[model samples]
Target: EDALYQKLYASLKNRELATKDRTERNSMFARRYPSHAQEESKKQHDHFSLKAAQSDASVEASRLRRQQHFTELASIMKSSNESRINSASERARHHFATVQGEREGKWSNTRQRFDEIRSREQEQRDQIAEMRIIHSNELSFRGTKNSGSISPTSTLRAQTPGSISYFSNNDDETAKTGAVADRLISRILKAANSGKHRRPSEVGSVFESSNCVSSLNTSPSREKPREIDDNATDKTQI
Candidate 1:
């Protein structure tokens, strides 16, 4: 409060001093000049005052124009900055969309390839299963055939007990024939169970069996007549 009062007093004191100086100068000029001359000087002062007022108006106009120009420049700079920001944002958005599209396309292609591979794998599994089933069925069929062939021979032997009389006189020939039949049956069973082609030895064995059968059919049997003892019969009568 005191400083404000001091500043006010200083401004009033400056104003009073300026007024006194103006009054003294005016009084001195009044004393030096006649009435008409004073009137002429007042006219000149008015004219100079008018000229100074005009100059002040021109300076104010120039300052206003400079301020208006600065305001326009600021507005233009702000608009340019906004436009640049908008363009950059648009470009970023477009780039993001493009990258996403490429990623999605890659993912779709990978999924398609995966599906194809899975389908092929499933097909392969089905084929392998089918082949296994076929192999099992073939093995079972071969086993059934072997059993049927062996069953007939066994049934025949069981049904014809009296047929042994044909070879009763030749025990060795009967034994040889039985052993050959057993060997041939065993070899056939082995070939069937193995599920493979027959070897050369097995084929030769088949020919051997055929030859034995042929020889047996063509050869004649040797038989001896029985002799009676008369002394033993006569002792039994006595």
Candidate 2:
């Protein structure tokens, strides 16, 4: 009985030692390797971090794209505005040039018309001056001789080889006629020189004076008196 008790106690002690060693070995392995639940939690954390980083990158890229689009739009708008302004400026210049050209053309035409009228007036004045000179010379020539009675009121005689005298038997009538002729001639000359037009009444008076002088020239006249011719022959004989 004593042997059996000893054997039984030994057996119990061995079993306890064996159980303690096995428990210590299990603790060591647990410390050396992580649990499945802990690894899964760590992987989830890493995945969340990567997803957040990717989202940030996407947002930055979107911001860049939007900025580029805005810049391009601004450039296009600026170009369009400049083109419109240039077009407007060009149109304005063209309109101004057209208007100015038309005005110049009108002014040139007006100037040409004015020059034509002035030239025509000048030509008329020149014709009048020539006519006056011719009439004056004719009047001097027609006054040079007289013998037979022309009219009861007037006579013409030689004053010198180159000159003549004309007078009326009535002194008042002669003076009046002479004064009228001189006044008419002076007025006509003044009007021509001053570029003034004469009234029809005044022109008619001048024509009347000319007709009177022409009538005097047309009247019968002897070449010389008979007494003067006889004296001239006697002088030649002497």
Candidate 3:
């Protein structure tokens, strides 16, 4: 019995030790599993943060590029506007110069025309003065010629061709008296033929008694009456 009891106690002690060892191993396995899981979670969080940072940097770069492009475009537009303005100014200057040249040309033409008109007026005035001088000279010459040839002595000389003197009777006076007597005789003959009964003695008495015959015969004894010849008398009567 002593031997059997000793064996039983040894068996009980060995079983207790085995149980303590198994408990220690289980505690160690639990601690190691929790530590590994914590490490994996930290790694995942770091990857997500890095991707977010990269995305932010890309967005900033795109914004900067857009701003630079806009700045360059504005500068180009300003340069184009300045060029257009300069071209317009140059055109305006050229137009003004053309207008000034035309005005000067017109002024020159007007001055030339005025000078020509003045010259023509002066020529006309000279011609009128010359004409007046010529007219005055002609009138003076005509007055002098008319005054020189109308004297009393010139008139008496112009009439001297027809004067005649009769002592018994000049040829012109005898011709005129004979013509009167012949005309009376022809009248008396015509009266006798017509049975009016006038005699030749009666006709002579009527002729001698005429007042016109007595006056013609009794003219101034110093100056005789002028008798016109037959041809000259016809011309004068005409």
Could you tally the backbone clashes for each prediction? 0, 0, 0
**Which 10 residues in a row give candidate 1 its minimum summed lDDT?**
146-155
List the candidate 1 regions with Cα displacement exceeding 4 Å. Answer: 1-26, 32-52, 128-238
Q: Please write out the lDDT profile of model 1 over residues 1-238, one tens digit for every residue.
A: 9999999999999999999998888788778876966897899999999999999999999999999999999999999999999999999999999999999999999999999999977766665555455444433322111111111111111113112111222335444444544455455445544544568787666747655445344223422312213332211000
Q: Per-residue error at 50 for model 2, in Å? A: 3.5
Best by lDDT: 2
What candidate 2 gets wrong by more than 4 Å, as runs, is 1-52, 124-180, 193-202, 209-238
Alpha-carbon lDDT of model 3: 0.52
Query: What are the models' TM-scores?
Result: 0.38, 0.47, 0.33
Sorted by TM-score (best first), the order is 2, 1, 3
Worst 10 residues of 2 by lDDT: 229-238
Between candidates 1 and 3, the one scoring higher on lDDT is 1
Candidate structures ordered by lDDT, highest first: 2, 1, 3
TM-score, cand. 1 vs. native: 0.38
